[model samples]
Target: MGRRRSAVLTVLIALVAIYSLVPLAWLVVNATKTQEGLLSSFGLWFDDGRFALFDNVRQTLTYDDGVFVRWLGNTLLYVVAGAGGATLLATLGGYGLAKFDFPGKRAVFAVVIGAVAVPGTALAVPTFLMFSRMGLTNTPWSVIIPSLVSPFGLYLMWTFSQQAVPDEMLEAARIDGAGEFHTFFRVSAPLLGPGIVTVLLFTVVATWNNYFLPLIMLKDPQWYPLTIGLNSWNDQAQTVGGQAVFNLVITGSLLTILPLLAAFLLLQRYWQSGLAAGSVKE
Candidate 1:
């Protein structure tokens, strides 16, 4: 009976894995085809005698005077500044909330919780109006400023800090005459490695994949991120008499996901550790 059940579970797991990986496999297979090959060949299989992955990549990078490269740079800028800033602020805010006592602390906690519950889509229009009034719309500041606030990241760090850090160690540092900043940096920071990486990965992925906010905020193609830029290419095919660069779009998408895949691969350990935190008593 046990063996039968185990085999059934293994089959289910294999099915789930295939379900998740099939789209990625399709994307990989199609990215290697040319414009003509893509329309002519099967999506899940490579085109015979016409592997144009490098050619598609070259055209993707050089198309429209290298707009794809510009969009890539813009994405990097948003991730570094917007996501990086969000992680830093979340780390500090969460640490303070977890470690310190202050007036209105309960109120702050309530606000953070409320913010986390609110969906970003609900705030998009209001944020757009606010930025428009400030003359910040259509500029990178609009996107960067909004991206800096990650309620979920703050909450994750807050929860992680409470368990990962001990009050006794902080007291010992204080008794040894270490200032708050010094103690946090030297003591608490080390213990927060996994949590920090987790939050960073969250923020980076959020900013990298952000579409709605940037869509409503930016109008200039020069300032567009890869998501919007790739979307524009896709939309071109939908328009009447518009030039379709579906091959470039497919190749660009593959390129777009490579960095994120690399990030997850490199930070897998830290992210797993972060998730497992507080699962066991110390």
Candidate 2:
């Protein structure tokens, strides 16, 4: 009975893996094809006799005065600022909530939980209006500011800190004449590594992939991130007399995802440990 159940579970897991990987497989295969070949060949198979991967990449980078490169830079900027800021804020906020006791703590928890329940799309319009009043619309700050608040990241850090950081350790640090900042930097911060990396990965992915907010906030093509820029390239195919650069778009997309993949591959160990940290308690 156990062997039969194990086989069934293995098959199910394999199916799920295949299902998730098919699109990525399709993207990889199609990225190698030329515009004509992409239209003519089977999507899952490589185009025969005309491998355009290098050419497509060159064109993607050099296209329209190297706008794609600019967009990539903009995306990196957003990720570094918005995502980095969000991770730092979430860590500090989470650590505080986990360790410190203060007035209205329950209220603060409720507010954070409520914020987490609110979808970002629901807040977009209101945020746009507020930014417009502040004359921050069409600027990078509009996107950066909004991306800094990660309620989910904060909550995850809070839970992780509760388990990962011990009150007794903090008391010991305090007893040793260590200041709050010194203790946090010297003792608790080291212990929070996995949680920090977890939050960083989440925030980086969020900021890097953010589209709707930047779409609504920014007007300048120079400030457009890869998401919106690639979207614009994709949209070009829809307009009358528009040049169809689908090959560049596909190549650009492949380029865009490489960083995220690298990030996951590099920090997945920390991310996994961070997720499992609070689940088991002694």
Please give the clash total of every predicted structure, in order.
Answer: 0, 0
TM-score of each: 0.93, 0.94
Q: What local distance difference test score does each model get?
A: 0.93, 0.92
How would you encode candidate 1's per-residue C-alpha lDDT over 1-282 as one tens digit per residue?
999999999999999999999989998999898778877888898898678999989999999999999999999999999999999999999999999999999999999999999999999999999999999999999889999999999999999999899999999999999999999999999788888898999999999999999999999999999999999999996678554588888899999999999988988877677557645537
Model 1 bad stretches (over 4 Å): 1-9, 240-244, 270-282
Which pairs of residues have clashing backbones in candidate 1? none
For model 2, how does the per-residue alpha-carbon lDDT over 1-282 read when each residue is reduced to its tens digit? 999999999999999999999988988888899989988899999988699999999999999999999999999999999999999999999999999999999999999999999999999999999999999999999999999999999999999899899999999999999999999999998789888998999899999999899999999999999999999999996677554598888889999999999999989977677557645635
